[model samples]
Target: MKVKVQSLDGGKPGKDIELSDEVFGVEPRADILHRVVTWQLEKRRGTARGARERSDVARTGKKFGRQKGGGTARHGDRRAPIFVGGGKAHGPRVRDFNPSLNKKVRMLGLRMALSSKARDGNLVVVDSLDVKEAKTKALKERLGTLGLGRTALVIDGDALSVGFALASSNLREINLMPAVGANVYDILNHDTLVLTRAAVEKLEARFNG
Candidate 1:
């Protein structure tokens, strides 16, 4: 698949570039994408903390009162849950939230995410993100000219350009990342996906490498 490349400012139009069918031409599968997204989010969850149980607490195990009724009632050990500063009767146990997933599923989901953007015409190929001035206003005007959607995720080559990164840092609607950091969650989160020429090469090479 070939996509036209343009400058970020939309002033210069570059040559068209070819995209990989396996990467950007795939037919999206919602189920596969859901599984991968769920897996990714699940891994970010923290384990539930557990409270100390009766056995775990450091309390006197000695008999508190006589076996026979002594005035009020007979009592066993101070470690009993009813006593003050005693261990809890039932406490939640620690549980790890990490879930295992197959590697292929993750890869397929990423491809589908990229393909979804391409198929929907939400993918924009750019010559580069290099800007003379790293001013946020200038960059914003430039992006506005491009007519990118509500939210845009720009993927650069192996390393992001410092100027573009700094310029877009304050803009909540615009996200910047390197090709290595591109994933299904971030890709699908944005309304538009912008790929630089270098990013395109790296992404294609990544799957085909």
Candidate 2:
């Protein structure tokens, strides 16, 4: 796909960039996308979740009462799951939720995400962005020039310019990341995908390499 490169002022860059078909033209797989997204979210969980099980609860192993009670139902240990403040049965425990997915699936998921963005006209290309100092105002102005107000993801080919990263650090709606760090969540979360010409080339190479 051929897309016009825009300047920071939203004006045409006097040049256009041709995106690769392999990277931005793949058919989206909803199932893979869903699985990948779920995997990503699961991997972020902390190992703090815990629950007391029957074995963990303190209770005498001896019979609390005769196997057959006189009037009431047979009684067991105080830590039985039925009793209040007793240990939980088959409750959630601290463990990993990560699912194993093939590397090819992951790559396809990313490509599909990019393709979806491209098809929806949510992707934008720019020649380059230069920021001498790390200032949020400067980044905000740049985004305004592009007429991107809602959540935006800025992708740079190499290491993010120190100034640009600093400027975007405080903005919750704007995210700046290097090409290597790009992920499905960031791409889908933003209302628009802003890519520099070099960034686009680098992304294609990484995916098609």
TM-score on alpha carbons, each prediction: 0.91, 0.76
The sequence of per-residue lDDT tens digits that candidate 2 reaches over residues 103-206 is: 88888889999998899888988877666556788768777777674889999988676777777889988888889988887788889999988799899999
Q: Which parts of model 1 are misplaced by more than 4 Å? A: 9-11, 72-74, 82-85, 89-92
Candidate 2 weakest lDDT stretch, 10 residues: 7-16
Count of backbone collisions in candidate 1: 0
Question: Per-residue lDDT of 72-115 in model 1, one digit per residue for the tens?
Answer: 56767777788888887888888888899898888889899999
Who wins the lDDT comparison?
A: 1
- Model 2 ranges off by over 4 Å: 9-14, 49-92
Error of 2 at 60 (Å): 10
RMSD in order of candidates = 1.9, 3.9
Q: How many steric overlaps does candidate 2 have?
A: 0
